[model samples]
Target: MKTFSAKAEEVEHDWYVVDAEGKALGRLASEIAFRLRGKHKPEYTPHVDTGDYIVVVNAEKIGVTGNKEKDKMYHRHTGYIGSLKSVPLGKLRETHPERIIETAVKGMLPKNTLGRNMYKKMKVFVGPEHTHQAQQPKTLDI
Candidate 1:
């Protein structure tokens, strides 16, 4: 018996649409990361970009438990000294809802070039409307 390893050129990427309304942040992100990494496929190859494209909608309605809404802080630093900046999850939702899911899923992916390529396959929208209708993505229930 021989082990099967999928190749990048031989892999077929499928498009899937997910509704984020009322879904838990962490759980949803993990699921999205799973699909993005192509783990759901039988021919998954870790070294290859075998993930499928994911379209996430209703990002503004994603849910979080406990005090995460206010207590969970996202931090960033500027190039200049003393330029650290932070924002609460609640505030970030109001300003950039799409980033909420994006950040969560990003953290779950591999921290390398392969991960960045997989991350690019995900598309997030604040509302139900997305521009990927042309691809006829199937609805993915998480």
Candidate 2:
């Protein structure tokens, strides 16, 4: 029997809704990344984008286990020297809660073009409301 390899055109993408309220950030991000990479599906193919769309809500309520809120720092660099900037997780949550989840999930995915394509399938929102209602996404419990 020939080994199965999923094709992009043959893959079916489903939309799933995840509630981030009161959930651990790392665990939630891992699950979301798993689905986004299509690892949960039997037809997963490494070269093809076989992931599903994930819509995450209530990002502001996501929990951290330890002092990550204060000690965990997000760093960025401007083009020039000595232009590095950092922000604590706590501040990021207050300013851009969605980014906390996005950053976590992004780190878990492959560092390639395929990974970037899969990452685009996710949508994160700060509150309980999302605009993907038209997709009729089913609730996905992590």
Number of residue pairs clashing in candidate 1, backbone atoms closer than 3 angstroms, sequence gap of 3 or more or interchain: 0
Task: Provide the overall lDDT of each model, using Cα atoms, as 2-decimal numbers.
Answer: 0.96, 0.95
Looking at model 1, which ten-residue stretch has the lowest summed lDDT? 72-81
Across 49-129, the per-residue lDDT of candidate 1 in tens digits comes to 898999999999999999999999999898899999999999999999999899999999999999999999999998999
Candidate 1's displacement at residue 96, Å, is 0.5
Clashes (backbone N, CA, C under 3 Å), per candidate, total 0, 0
Looking at model 2, the pairs that clash are none
Residue 122 shift from truth in candidate 2, angstroms: 0.4
CA error at residue 92 for candidate 2, angstroms: 0.7
C-alpha displacement of 138 in model 2, angstroms?
Answer: 0.5
